[model samples]
Target: MGLISEVLLLPLAPVRGSAWAIRQALREAERLYYDPAAVRTELARLEEQLEAGEITEEEFDQREDELLDRLEEALRRRGATGEGTAL
Candidate 1:
């Protein structure tokens, strides 16, 4: 006697391309904003360093200006529309 068995199987679609495409999309997003939290935190720390005498006032001012400019530009590019005050 022969017995027949049947099983329900789900099809697996290709997700390799999806993963790459997602990564590419994320890279594009990051290129615009990159990381606002980290940038802001570092900028605050630079200010603190100046306050604590770790960095000279002139050095602190220069670095802070550079970081602020970059952050504002990135924010504007990300559609924050110059109102990127916080969060």
Candidate 2:
């Protein structure tokens, strides 16, 4: 950008910096969310929660299905990227 444009945008620098930080945080969050190990840990936690009566059967079933789907997707991603051992 030209000097004039940079000067004009100086006032918004903080806002732009905040937006960049948020995007970075989201990227990291998604990476962890799709990690195979993280998914497995979540699955175990969900099972434990169900056994503890912390969640109803319907809720458990729904969450379990979602987690299983994530697991499958994570495995597929691992195979495509060669980042982790496929399940």
Give all TM-scores, in the order shown. 0.54, 0.71
What is the per-residue lDDT of model 1 for residues 18-82, given as tens digits with 9 covering 90 to 100?
77889999987777454667678889899889889999988998999988987777666557655
Model 2 TM-score is 0.71
In candidate 1, which residue ranges exceed 4 Å CA deviation? 1-33, 80-86
lDDT of 2 by residue, 1-87 (tens): 999999999999999999999999998988898888888999999999999999999999999999999988888888888786745
Q: Candidate 1: worst 10 consecutive residues by lDDT?
A: 4-13
As a whole number from 0 to 100, the lDDT of residue 70 in candidate 2 is: 94
Best-matching candidate per lDDT: 2
Per-residue lDDT value at 37 in model 2: 87
lDDT of 2 at 44: 96
What is each predicted model's overall lDDT from 0 to 1? 0.72, 0.91
